[model samples]
Target: MTGLGDSRHVVVVGASLAGTRTAQNLRALGHTGPITLIGAEAELPYDRPPLSKDLLVSDWSDETVEGFRLATSAELDDLNLDLRLGVAATALDPDTRQVTLADGASVDYDVLVIATGAAARPSPWRPASGLLQLRTLSDARAIAARLALREPVVVVGGGFIGTEIAAAAIKLGCPVTVVDPVAEPMTRIVGPEVAGSLVDLHRANGAATRFGVGVVDIRGEAGALTVVLDDGSELTASTAIVGIGSVPGTAWLEGSGLTLDNGVVTDARLRAIGVDDIYAIGDVARWPHPGLGAHRAEHWTNSSDQARFVAAAIAQDAVLEYSSTDYVWSDQYDWKVHTVGWRDPQGSSVLVGDLAADGRVAVVHADADGNACGAVTINWVRALNQARRLLMAGDTAEAIAEQLEQLTVRAA
Candidate 1:
């Protein structure tokens, strides 16, 4: 495999984890290209998971959210790659191989990597002032300031981000209430049984869980928010944090001719189907998985891994078939919950280990053939490691259970 065409002009969008990793890999793979890193955010690329966890509770300053730079100023200076920050790509012309920026600048690319991650989905009903969505560093900083006041916080949506924010608010000694339309929290992701555990945990922590309730409207400024539920009940709070979900940042690709279902459709190689010389990765990419079949994973592990795979492919190497180890973790209430592989809802769900009061729990999702479709462990590091190993070895759930029993005995 030789360098496809002149690999001199490489353009990457988004500057998020996936974009940064892809840039790093492009250089590391011996591609002598003038890489251009473009980002819409004013600040340098930063980590996001901590924004909902430690940043909310800790006294971390706003400037601390600069994030881990894949290539520092010195490194970037040495590499001499063009760095364009706070500018959005407005359009893409595949025929001309050019990207038009919002500033009316055109960047021609020999090869383009689309890593324009997703933005937090805005609430349908706008607040009197404005609803809050924690996606960027600025968003996180503002939320942290509100939580520091130790005032009543109302969080809409029970997804991982919302739950983590709610738990962080509780830890910050603020009155917290979570309102979700679902009959149970996290029912859409982990089903009723797992959701039940979360329900109990939230209650035990003294956080109000208003299940089956939907927020019809939010009124008032950032200092005071009035939340009207679907049942016509109203609750006033000092702050309202909305984390319904996220949508792909692909509005710029409206007429790109590349498929965009929930996100940019890609094959297993993370290459956009029907589009040549372009690749998409991260939260905005929906690619087929070998183990989970055709599915788009919005996990951090998936983003970074996909970036590496795409980078190798870009370098024209004899690329290995893309497959995921399927790792994702969330932090809340002193518990570290990790999941490897997609949870097969139709498969059998089993609680293999007791979490006890300390928030240690392990559960496995098995297919009809007893293969491990997914595994989730709360505050159980050993269980997470074993699950990851089984996923890599392609072991079935029944075999994993047998191995888990031995682990329990050893712990005993």
Candidate 2:
């Protein structure tokens, strides 16, 4: 394996949050090596969470939503970091440590960080222009234009992205309907108990929630879109947004000989499992999670934490293991949802607080032997943090409930 750190060429692909942070941390670690940031998007790296929230509310200006621009043209000039935008990587030759761009140009690097991230998976059932996918700033901008028409909008997929966009459309005074195959939104992530609360949240906000249904087909004509559901129901609107899911952007690494499953397979250290001097992070990484004890591809906290860990490892020239705290956060309507660790409701679960009646609540998931597996919190950041610490301490369901009760008593 080639040594990293001093005078090495570190190339990071995908200029999203993870890629940008990797570059920033590399500099912070005092690595004087040449750094190159490559991105397929035309615009600079920006925050994606806000695209569904603030951008839809019309509160965020165009420039403000462009997210955190780590380095500007002048900043790049001063730092002498090569910032390549609007160029798609065509292939990767791990043996040669060379990245081939679409323009037939190749860049060699001593150390490579594959932060290619993930792309919005296009709907297989929809026509070329029948559905709109949300991922990039351009996608958001296009959807915004459609929402401005104030016509009825149907959002496919009831996950966080779909629900958030639906709420935003509701705020815009547009009649919005959400369709999903699952019985409740966010069931896969937060489980039915927590996801059911979200159903009520959307309903309370005057957005129609159609669960246990899927958009079988989409047909568009004359500047209008029609979405057909599995149950013979049809929804027509001027615009339709599809939030199905995303696939890892590792197409260029097809013949790289590095492990690739849902994402580029990497060890806990974020290094490609079988290749030296090659690493993967962000949404494009599939690593065995510390809490889950299984390989998973997560989009948010995983990326951030892995970037920091990999940066330090590259700088120190040592193999460092990355263990996730398994933290993921989401904002829906007036509720702030935070999840920590991995939770299975089939396991022992204690209703830490009153959830049936609502207000705010917390649910702690425990394993068969009573060890805390994870927790789901609604609008309860303080309690969530408490749960996180308690889980890390190997607390049980009863213990966590006691802690929650103590928190409630203190709040009173």
**RMSD for each of the candidates:** 2.1, 2.1
Candidate 2 per-residue lDDT, tens place, 145-186, comes to 877777888889888898999988888888999999988768
lDDT by residue for model 1 over 1-412, one digit each (tens)? 3554435588998888888888887777777868898899866677778888876676674445433345566766666679898999999988888999998999999778999989999788677763678998789878877888888989998889999999998998899999998878676566555678887788889899888988888988876778999999998888898999899989998898888888888876777887767888999988888656667677788889988888888776545668887888887687677887767667786776666643567777786666778788877889879877886687878787677767877877
**Global lDDT of each model?**
0.80, 0.81
Worst 10 residues of 2 by lDDT: 66-75
**Best lDDT among the predictions, by candidate number:** 2
Give the clashing residue pairs of candidate 2, or none.
Answer: none
lDDT of 1 at 261: 88
The whole-model C-alpha lDDT of candidate 1 against the native structure comes to 0.80
